[model samples]
Target: MPAVTVEDLTVLPRLARPGLGDQPRPVWQVTNAPSGYEGEGFPVRRAFAGIDLSHLDPFIMMDQMGEVNYAPGEPKGTPWHPHRGFETVTYIIDGTFDHQDSHGGGGTITNGDTQWMTAGAGILHIEAPPEWLVQKGGLFHGIQLWVNLPRDAKLEAPRYQDLRSGTVALATTYDAGALVRVIAGSVDGHQGPGSTHTPMALVHATVEPGARLELPWEVEYNALGYVLNGSGTVGADDRPVRTGQATLFGPGDYLTYAADPVQDGRAVTLDVIIVGGRPIREPIAWAGPFVMNTKDEVLTAYEDYQRGRFGHIPV
Candidate 1:
């Protein structure tokens, strides 16, 4: 397994880079972003939101919002917006967010809760800190990932899976130093409750210092790890990753992550999310909130929103 050191948190021992048939091990691909800002009205890094839909198939965009310690009166959030032809998965780590859509769906996703919305046909929604949170002001950290829909399911219908914190599936590693919350996929034999438009796994893992976690994944799926907190090494290339960085893994049957051992009394843990899915070979035409297969379809989505087809939130 690849390893990371506790001192400087750099990659330590890297195991053999294996071939596909060599019992499946993840090869470190690329490390990008010292981290930057993108549309959360806060600091965030754009994960898979790119033009190459075929490459990051079944997944479109991922935004990691603040693990920010917001000062007492300065919280930011987005207003009502329209989306079509895809799904948006929102995972909250800390703080509160009240979500509402025109389809008569609205709920709150507090810490560890998930809101998986399939904007199959089209829908308008609002996501912002709740009245209580906005009034009191505190830390707010979360992510919203866009999962692409195939051409057939593009306009099926809009749906929402507002999962509570306790209801989400949890799995423990054999040694018990780690806990994984399966949001949309299986991890360590436990499966998430969220449904999917694509075959994928979205898991948030927290591993204690000195623990080496090896996760098995389908060989045909594409996977990557995002370091949300602390530091660790990822994959057989044993790429060292600190907070706010994302590492894409090459083909492998299992991915390895190791948190640095404790130097002083305090130990460095690893908090990250692993996303993997079977590639959906399809064309993509995306414009802001609307993701479709053609430019004309994109235009139609905009026109529909402009024409008030997507319902509105009551004032």
Candidate 2:
């Protein structure tokens, strides 16, 4: 686990979306203003595609979205949808979402709130627009991440944790002018909220221009960085990376980053969800929004949702 310089890092090609029926469009590499949700009014833009990291080992996908304004009294999000075999984390950076699920979980995720939902066996849920955000006409932005459950926990009982911003801890490494907020794991001797059933670590980071930060890597896991704003170079081997992109690191024990000194007025801020576990290496039978090891399991999940197996959640 020797430390490598940034110069040796290789830049991998960005992943593209798979073909859809008849025709399909190319996928984007960086986070952009999301188009309105398909059929629904919420905005959604994918941050990663084709499943990064180990298959159902640690994390599966990441989607970042924003809504600056919504029509008055208009619905703002996806209708009830089903999910199984994974955990969903919705972190609200701004605005609010009135969320409800079939398992008797319902609440509003306000600014700086986090909703961790484990759709272990099965769950149908919907996230709707909050009246305040719709009325005030302000900016709303956040991210949704999907973490895969371990094989043993795939069929476990579902649960939810609504965490306030004050409950999470933040640590700033002054040397690099970097702020690391612990959302799921330990960072700089500080721990985050909500215990994860699987071994996972997530941190939201911000770096000032010309600053350099070093991240210690863990063995037995894959690591990647998602740039949210500004631009910089990230990698153990001095690879040149920029904002609106994800840098997948190769096998290494540590990573180093340096903000572009030339961009003196600009800074780089990003969320790094470092996740990995013993790789499942099993077949991935994914359709629509559900991912399972076998196609039969996926079909069963859809059937269960349609049959009202996931009954209405109480407010």
Could you estimate the TM-score for every candidate?
0.87, 0.79
Model 1 residue runs over 4 Å out of place are 1-22, 34-40, 49-52, 263-268
**Whole-model lDDT per candidate:** 0.75, 0.62
lDDT of 2 by residue, 1-315 (tens): 000112211231111222232121112222333233642756665665544445335667777665344455553677788788888998876677788877777898776678999988888888877766566565566778888776677777889988777777665544535555567765435667967886666666655577665654444555656665566766534556654466555554545565665552333243343443345555666677677778898899788877877676555
Global lDDT of model 2: 0.62
lDDT of 1 by residue, 118-155 (tens): 99889999888877776788888888888999899999
Clashes of 2: 7
* Model 2: per-residue Cα lDDT at residue 146: 83
lDDT for residue 212 in candidate 2, whole number 0-100: 63
